[model samples]
Target: MVSDTLKAVMQKEGVVAIVAQGKAFPHVVNTWHSYVSVGNDSFIVPVGGMHGMEEALNHDNRVLVTVGSKEVEGLHGMGTGFLLSGHAKMISDGEEYALMKKNYPWARAIMNITILNAIQTV
Candidate 1:
């Protein structure tokens, strides 16, 4: 579960990194984007590239997400870490895909991510 404060932090500082285990080796890809909470314990992150990045998604679906912001004044600041466990599936549903596509015009395609797990970092 994510607290209101943590969620706020994520909104400010969040980076989604995707890692896939390929046939020969493991490859990693990352990007920065806006993330929003879709449910009580779920978050949706739009991932671009529908066909070109198919290989990466097929190989592996494990992803690592980190969220945090810089310190201000004398306040003690810390970052939170979340390990997401969900497979990357291409948006096939037209209506749903269209909605995602509408938000990201620059992306060739988009994939909706359903967060499975979230953990706080020490």
Candidate 2:
């Protein structure tokens, strides 16, 4: 289950650490911008400027997401963060995509993450 603290961090910061990797390359990008939880293990994050993600998204469907603390509240000096492992599916048109568009009107796509694990610090 995704803890309340993690969700709080996501809601409070609206950014996440996304890592996409393939056999020959690894890419990390912060905030395609606008992330929201649909359920305990499901989330939708808008993606823009996807040039860096194209290779990984094509070679793999799994992605790593880290949220909270330094990435979310670094400027505010908040402590800790969480890690989420999940499968991501790209969507350009759908209910989730519509919501993504509502939240980030300029986003080119939406990544629906079906979280399988949640790791956090005390």
Query: What lDDT does each candidate get?
Result: 0.54, 0.72
- Poorest 10 consecutive residues of model 2 by lDDT? 69-78
Off by over 4 Å in 1: 1-6, 35-43, 50-53, 71-76
* Clashing pairs for predicted structure model 2, backbone only: none
In the range 1-122, model 2's lDDT, one tens digit per residue, is: 77666666666655677787866877777772235545788877677776667567778878888776554433336666777888877788978788768878988887788899887743
Best by lDDT: 2
Over all chains combined, what TM-score does candidate 2 have? Answer: 0.79
lDDT of 1 by residue, 6-78 (tens): 5555566456565556667756656663644344555554555434345766766654455544421112345
| Residue 67 of model 2, lDDT score | 71
TM-score of candidate 1 against the unseen true structure:
0.66
